[model samples]
Target: MSDTVDETASGAATDPVLQRLSTLDRFLPIWIGVAMAVGLLLGRLVDGLDDALAAVEVGSVSLPIAIGLLIMMYPVLARVRYDELGHVTSDTRMLGASILLNWVLGPALMFALAWLLLPDLPEYRTGLIIVGLARCIAMVLIWNDLACGDREAAAILVAINAVFQILAFAFLGYFYLQVLPGWLGLEQTALDVSVWGIAKSVLVFLGIPLLAGFLTRTLGERARGRDWYESTFLPRIGPAALYGLLFTIVLLFALQGDTITSQPLDVARIAVPLLAYFVLMWGGAMLLTRALGFDYPRATAVSFTAAGNNFELAIAVAIGVFGVTSGQALAGVVGPLIEVPALVGLVYVSLWARRFFRDAPSTDPAVPDTGATR
Candidate 1:
């Protein structure tokens, strides 16, 4: 009976159908969108999402909040191969380029775009800048891997961004608050709770995952091969993490659904600056990568690093500090709506650009000529 049970389990685990489903697991970004659409549709049909959010709470924890943190951790932990840490120091140039673009150029462009275009909507303007300062802690690594980036380079860049954002984001938040016109009183209020609260959220969201990842590698090394650790275990966690995250997005959207519905004008209010930020950063990264003579993978990494925001962390922090009723929280909720789809498009663009750099490509190759003789 034991033998039969083991056989059944193994067969299920190795099923070809399951392997195919695993591909879907990798595309969590798409699932995230689906979750959002479904949640919004549900919220619309029902009265409001507030009760749903309230129902999801457990003690100090909410299911949505738990899911958000999980999503951030799983991606980072899965991609972090401790053996590859040695490679980071070697690929300093690519890492340097990513840091310069994501930290310096990305934040600066976002600040300018928000400042210039969103002066009227101070809360959302602050939210937009928060999105910018946070950088791409999780998604850019996925982009790097998809684009066939040097993993070492990508890891180094992610680690650096994670650390710097804690410090830089607080300062950037203060800076944005200070510069906004005195007429925008929301800035002063946001400035009051901003830095310290964000600092704590950073600690909870990033610190725990990082430590867990490191410890998991250290302990698991003796018991299992790295392939088993990654392919067998990490793959299982990927889908779960993404689903959790999207569910969180749903709750967040639901929480703000009524306000969003009532104030349709807010959509138009925030759209301009968000659209402008996306275009400017994407264009700037592509141009800068070209100027620096980076290959396709490195270029793709840079472009995404600049383009993507740490929306998971942003939403979690925004909700925690700014009330769920606040426009800042609403803006954080809106971020992934644009970000997920835009990134999928950017992934395709990166794949398309791959052909320019080399004769043979890893993902998809150009068709070879065939005679009509067949």
Candidate 2:
């Protein structure tokens, strides 16, 4: 196990892709804080900008945020080798574990934490639940690649999570938010969660970008050749997603600056449960990987996929289900604020964890462990 970790670490020390993570990527948390500060300043100085941006909406989705999210998702999806999705059927253990973690455990954990921590703040509790139910499909790819995880497995898990989210997100959300609260004898305001509304947000936020990414990769590879497409074109386009992420953060904070400034304690209260959720989920996923005896790459992939949340989808849903100005929406905006830094730190932890796991054994005959970093 120690030798496998040593080799992976040594390989990572020289890996060009890992080394190329820019200053922006390394200090993403700092940049996010700067964005928040800038947004607050702009909100105070440039009165009516947030109102004007908020006016541009389509079916409850904010136009600027929708655009930012689409750009943020495209590069990550484009990197997926869709041809390798066939491998999903062979790795049933990994798939099953992901389903259990993402669908069952993740939401339940958030539900408990939100109720326990923010009992007086129902809107924030709902927002936390929304975030918990929406499993990650996009940024997990970036984190997986950065940590030298099994890219193919990461891609498959992402695809699986996307499908499950579309089918179950609405139903699960309805149950947790409306039905479960009633069942638990809590006085909760009834929320009209339309399945079609959830589906529409999923389609716009995920489905469209997914199709665009597929077409771009397919056409680009055929035109420029796979080597050039992978080596040159991808590197050029990949950072666009991170740029979009930062831009989106600034917009969100700017829009909510008044609320954030007035009720700073509410933001802190919302943040506490979110912080606990991330730490607990990451720790649990790591333990699960170790117990299952997954190799370094696969373990890292599973750990990240399990821990990360789809903040974009969560934000969209919060706006759609609740109003754009609702506390729920504000809480959704805070999700990525906390997630970006927490996951980035976890990336380093995952890299360090590789040294403790045994080399991927040749036991899984159906899907041979390739141990290929790329």
Whole-model alpha-carbon lDDT for candidate 1: 0.61
Look at candidate 2 and tell me the lDDT of residue 140. Answer: 75
True-vs-predicted CA distance for residue 339, candidate 1, Å:
1.6
lDDT, candidate 1, residue 287? 72
Candidates' TM-scores? 0.74, 0.84
- Which segments of model 1 are wrong by more than 4 Å? 1-32, 45-63, 142-151, 179-190, 193-196, 312-323, 358-374
Instruction: Report how far residue 342 has shifted in candidate 2, in Å.
Output: 1.8
lDDT string for model 1 (1-374, tens) is: 00001113355456422122234433545776777677666666677456766676432235576556556455446456667677556756767777787877777787677777877777887777777777876656555544444444555666777777767776666666575434455345354445555555555555666677778766766689785765555544544444545666676566656656666678667766666777677767777777777665556666777788877667656667777677887777677667766666665566455545533233221211011011
The model with the greatest TM-score is 2
